[model samples]
Target chain A: MKKIINEPGKFVDEMVQGILLAHPGALRTVGDDLRILARADAPVSGKVGIVTGGGSGHLPLFKGYVGPGLCSAVAIGNVFSSPSSQQVFEATKAVDGGAGVLYLYGNYGGDVLNFDLACDLAELEDIETRTVLGRDDVASQPRERADDRRGVAGIFFAYKAAGAAAERGDSLDEVARIAEDVVVNTATMGIGISPTILPTTGKASFDLPDGEMEIGIGIHGEPGIHRGPLETADQIADRLVGAIIDDLSLADGDRVAVLVNGLGATPLEELYVLYRRVDEVLRGRGVEIERTYVGEYATSLEMAGASVSVLRLDDARLELLNAPAQSPFFREVSA
Target chain B: MRTADLNVVARRALADLVGYADELRDLDQALGDGDLGVTISLGAGAVIEALEQLPEDATAAELAKACAKAFANANPSTMAALVAGGLLAGSKTLVDSTEPNQADAARFVRAAGDNIALRGKTQLGDKTILDAIMPAADALEAGSDPVAALDAAVVGAERAVADTKALQSRRGRASWLQERSIGLQDPGATAFLRLLQCWQAALHAAPAERN
Candidate 1:
């Protein structure tokens, strides 16, 4: 029930205003409604545009990924809600260069509907678009039903690959293919020991006993697969990395990138603690760790937990991952 | 029917359908945020005014487009925008037609229904507005006479609304309720049914239909 804010209703708008004010050169509002934001120098002539969005409260998630060599635009919505189709269309229109646009976003019901509607609207304006959903949360659905799994931290890998492809002037179809490939190779699983308090309600997003943790937790506090007494850091890492390994079927000599992400309230030291165990488990299995990123890449407000995302790397994906990229919340300098 | 008179038919039907706005609001209250009634009432009023301003020689496609623009501008709700987009997509099937016949009515309704399904990421049994629309579209295409087609459409849509009562919602806010949403009449499906019945009544009273 305790938090810092001016008004609950103004939380999203104020946060967006702060971001716009803080990163004026890197971003610009696309539409008059203030719901859509695009790269400051968008419509890079002949480069395919990549538009990614979802609900708010997952800051540095949707809106934070808009800049050079990342998402070209974003349509932001309320906390844990889908943006309107018009907002999405506005973003598409603002960023579309001569090449077509790609809709890279999470797999959720409302977002899917709104984006598809925007695609239809974009067609009316002669702006071609392709879509690739981030369905990498292996805990939400089985590997066989990956298409239906909810997107989680693993989407960062997709954004990186797709954005780099677009910057290199890949055809719209090629960019889309690359995004879909990254999604296929990625898998994420999270655990939640604490829940977030929504700004409006000032109440918990979910309830759990004090000494227990929820495994396979969604960012929005959607019920995880199981609830059990809190385990040691190594055990937690084993559960998360173990599930990802089985899902992606990593074998000896397989190259992969690891992301140990904090779910809002967790600290950097704790993330590194988790990463320590992650490194041991992967190396023990003879998996070659090509890259390692540990931080709060995506978050669920003030929820206290972390997730692990593994992207099996090939030469092309590794190249995309290393390409020069910059966003407000993420960046990748030249090799 | 004369394409020029399409606006009049639409305006009259919309005005009549406004009578059920309160019922729609009540139904939506049980499932969603309860703005369906307000969206429809405001949208119908806006469309009525917009149709009044259309030129006497306006084509049916233009009329449909006007309805789409007016309805979308009437409210900021995602539902209104989606329905408006559906109307715009349906208008494409009328590309160069001067008059809209019974067949055109079937085509328009079915095209709109298909767009709503695809745009809404749903199918015939998703417990959204499409549940009522596709059944009505099928009936319209099956019937030979306009009057009979509308009658059959009404019956099909009514049956669909009743049948959907036992199914859980699969889209939009109602889906969040999971199994608890079952047994409630979907406000969206009901709204489409109301529109069909109003159109049927308006057509029956039209002087052009009599001729």
Candidate 2:
């Protein structure tokens, strides 16, 4: 509690102000609402615009994706809450080009309502709109109807594909289709070792035993499907990859891009350990790993856990996956 | 009947809360993340700043609107959003009115409870802030006088906080404790209850009636 802060209420505002101050050229806020985080040169013309939004605590998911060749705009909600319709509408207006706009985000209910509202507003403004929801978390719901699953780190893949499609001058409908395809091919599963603290309540979102983990935990502290004794790095990875593979119906000889993502408090060393095991599992299954991304692509602030996302890749998808993407949270390396 | 009329109460509650915020968070550091103090302080600060700029002669509900706006704009964290959700729920009960009656107050309390349930998915006995908040609301609704109602709420909340030690942490960080959390009162439940007690005492002693 000795941390330096002006006042608890001012933390987000001050933090938002500080972020803007630190990167004046990189971001701009819409009016008094801090939720709408947009690119500096927003409202690009002739090219389709991409926008994403979600709760605030997951730093890089919604806001961090707003940049060149990524999301043109992002509407940030409070931790675990969806941004208001007005915030989404403002972001839509800001990012709308002569070409239509695409509303790409998770399948959370509040987000669905607000983004739907934004789409209505955009239509009124003569800006065409398409939406692609990312629901790749197999842990949340069953795979027979995976659209009900929550979107986790796998959303980063959809963002990349959609952003690249928009950059390539594809229409908004084409971009939305490309993003939806990625979502369909993607599957994710997470394990939680610890819980996140809710800043306002100053309490943990959930609890775990010293030597146990909850498998299939949601980022917003939703109860996981099961809890069990602590397992080694390889064991945990095996469980996660096994669930994802089964959920996605990946057959032998399938190819994919792998993302081993940490849930905030998990260290790179541990993530790499899981990554190694996952690599082994996929290789053992004869699944070719076209690309591998390891690190905190998305997070549940300070929660100790990790998630695995695999997107079954075809040639076209692989090309888009290999395309260059630069954001505060992502970097691409040329092969 | 204007929002400005409630500024005195808002400022006093907020200032009083700054101390409570720091204290609550400090206590939470023992078992929680220690954000309660700072987040509440930040929320109060937002309201205080908003109050200073609001037009004079506003009503209690108007003042409440400003508070809600400040919360919506400033504190977007999950915890803040939960608090804001409950407050907004309460405010919605009186949005059309300039003042509050016992029925309106009761409606506000119920709305707050519902909002918290929807936002946090917490139930009583989960050793969450609801352990204190729900009973407090029920007591307030049943009390004869507003001050007495709030006082009853304070007592119910205090008792609930004490009983939390026996209950398991079902929702947040305390849940991580698993079974070890049995002996410790949830830091969030305690701080929130304590703040309410303080608010009741101050409201009982205030010179103006918030008319």
Docking quality tier of candidate 2?
incorrect
Off by over 4 Å in 1: B1-38, B41-70, B88-101, B118-128, B154-211
Model 1 CA lDDT for position A267? 94
> What's the lDDT for candidate 1?
0.90
Best by DockQ: 1
TM-score of chain A of each: 0.99, 0.96
For candidate 2, lDDT tens digit of each residue in A152-221? Answer: 8899999988888887788877898999999999998899998888666778888787999999988776
Per-residue lDDT of candidate 1, residues A1-335 (tens digit): 87778899999998888987887788888866667989889989999999989999898899878888899999989989899888888899899997999999999988998888888667656699999999999989998888899999999999999999999999999999999999999999999999988999889988989999999999999987899999999999999999999999999999999999999999999999999999999999999999999998889999999999999999999999999899888989997
User: Cα deviation of A88 in candidate 1 (Å)?
Assistant: 1.9
Give Cα distance to truth, residue A306, candidate 2, Å: 0.4
Best by lDDT: 1
Tell me model 2's lDDT, rounded to 2 decimals.
Answer: 0.78
Give a tens-digit lDDT track for model 2, residues B134-167. 8887987899977678778888988999998888
**Residue pairs in candidate 1 whose N, alpha carbon or C atoms collide under 3 angstroms:** none
DockQ of 2: 0.03
